[model samples]
Target: MSEVRVILHTDKRQALLREAQAEIRENQGRIPAGDFYARKLSAAWRRARGTRAYGPGEDQDDIGEFSLERFRDLPVTPRESLKAQPLRYAAVTPTEASEYYETTGTTGQPTPTPRLAEDTIWNTVSVAEAWRPLLGADERVVILLPSDVVPVADLVSGVCEYLDLAHIRAYPFATGITGWDRLEAMWRTFRPTTVFVAPGVALQFTRLLAQRGQLDELSSSVDRLACSGGGYTYTAAAGPGPSAARVGLARRTQGRPALPGGEASPGGRHCLHRPHRRTRAGRPG
Candidate 1:
């Protein structure tokens, strides 16, 4: 199948982001504590085959009590089925979708996932809101993540544009394009204050700077580092010595609890990173 071009309605998404941020602020970051998922589940019950196995119950007519037992009763969709017949799990048809993305197929066949504009807007707004406290107008962002055939890069890029921050897409892994040398050159010229990078790439780039004895010169300018994708090690963003403290880099799992050096944010497992500090970027746990 031919690739579907991604149309990012940046202006509209940005306006939505702003609206979402305003709503979040007004609500004090609190969401309806009651039956949120149940409401959605009730609405999707008729169309969602994943829930078709459920026996009829009187409570199914409305937003029923969502208990662990009730949830446990729902049938799990196997990966094979998802790969072979993705439409079985979809709420919208691929034709109705505005954007398309695919899994890496590392586990099996690549699964095609189509998304609506609402998906992009909601995801970007939620993530951007979580990270908003850490970013500012003066922040120049360098994204060292893949932009081809995946949604991760787009998500971060959307958040950057939504927040009106200056950012560039330069993946070091894209050899002959934004290779290590090119990335280093760009780093020097761009002097990015913030970076959203993959953990492995962050380590590789840090090591490159160390080998050239430019760690201090180059790293000094970077105040914040946010990493996603792959297994992360503390040293990936910390570099060596007191640089962790100097740069304010701390590693935490997303959405757990705020680490000692980091500030806490609500929502998602990837919220444990200390956004208030310039140095630590982990999946905020």
Candidate 2:
């Protein structure tokens, strides 16, 4: 019998459903892409309108006229780019934040990303809904990402806790707080059913295992391997990035672009152990 007892709080449920509904309606042509997008930006910008990031009412009125080019003038910036001074992008103060998590500093010195208490609450509920159908209580999970200060991934941990699933942590690798061999040993001992890791880290470990002639050590129990850092849906040339890791794949239609050959299909069901050629610190943008 399945032991999963997933329960979403009403506020969190409504928030997530709202986002999903909006996305579905937009994709189904019920909402005009440009005008609806402008309104969304206008709403978010309106929230952050009086912050240091936006610089006191600058670009306030032009929110409804938003265009793709308007991205250059938006008050928001990617968290990675603002890592050097993370709080500068925040609308709230440190006292209001619940915790802070730092990047692995693979490119340079680490940058800290802070989150409020409400952020964690929303995300915890969000992950439970998004991942519940794909995960089972009987399964064990191995998370290959940092968790000391509770980043977004921590919300997944919350789901694990709720479902009473065994979740093994391989955190220190991202921060160099621990080493690769330790992680390899844990994989051998735990044999996790689900593995969550960034794509770059996954490739790096693959190379290490292949060089050590231990490719077969990869767990067969794993039915789901979620690679984080999915990155931009659209590329710089205005093309979609490689859909190598779509977990909850969008609706498929004739005109819609299907995932390229050799990618994880819908349902998070996947096969691991294919050797990737590149070795990098973490997933690239």
Candidate 3:
């Protein structure tokens, strides 16, 4: 029952972060880099598992099939049974983890999503770099998403920290999550340049604002808006917004028809709080 302990050196961690950032900066968005990095991480996971984490006496892959060559194979993982209970899916033990996050589970019960610093460090670095182009270089952001262990708010806050953008995290959204009023108060005082929110909640919030005759104020206050989840139209990147404004939701973006928003769905979770691959730090289903 012994556990595997990965002692990643500081230099190696820094190197990983540097290379991840450089991958996006030097090459096309993430075409081949995503696959490349996934393989690299799989290898690292295998190495870290070593002669301890798997079981009492089980060592590394005994059959020598751990290699993951993209376009030709699947990456190595602990077991297929793990998928049935995703809340506990992880390469390391909770006690060994340097950090952790979880599902806001607005739809049902919550779940845990844990991780190590090594799994997150580069993912965090790469995300800030990826978002810099679409989200702007220095626009202050207000995250109006969940903030559980590794919720959207937490990740955006991390990206802002990495990129040096001024930002604030609103409380997690749910039926009675005592933070909408707080966010409104913050909006009045902080005047963030952009707002990141889920589509369902954003629509609800916008309706409430319109009822209070504050929609104009919101549009004028923030120059950019990023929306995640379905019910949005995706289009190629261009300067400014488009024209397909939703019914009863007239965006006050000067004369532009569409708002400066698109889907941030790298994974199923829509880490648009942020996500290159961020659900937990930067990876999720």
Q: Which candidate is the best by TM-score?
A: 1
Clashing pairs in 3: 101-149, 101-150, 242-257, 242-258, 243-257, 243-258, 271-274, 277-282, 278-282
lDDT (Cα atoms) of all candidates against the true structure: 0.57, 0.49, 0.50
**Candidate 2 structure quality by residue, lDDT tens digits, 195-241:** 76655556566556656655444634555665543321121110122
State in Å the error of residue 171, model 1: 1.5
How do the residues 23-113 of candidate 1 rate in per-residue lDDT, one tens digit apiece? Answer: 5555445674476556556545644433312324435433235554666676675767777776645656779877776664123466677
Quick one: RMSD of model 1? 7.7
The predicted structure with the larger lDDT, 1 or 2, is: 1
Query: Which runs of model 2 end up more than 4 angstroms from their true locations?
Result: 1-43, 55-86, 103-105, 108-112, 146-152, 172-178, 230-285
lDDT of 3 at 183: 63
- RMSD to true structure for each model, in Å: 7.7, 10.6, 10.8
lDDT of 2 at 244: 22
Reference-based lDDT, residue 223, model 1: 72
Please give the distance, in angstroms, between residue 228's alpha carbon in candidate 2 and its true position after superposition. 1.5
lDDT ranking of the models: 1, 3, 2
Q: Write the per-residue lDDT of candidate 3 for residues 164-228, one digit (tens) a residue.
A: 77887665364465456666667788887777666555655555565665554654556555654
How displaced is residue 151 in candidate 1, in Å?
A: 0.8
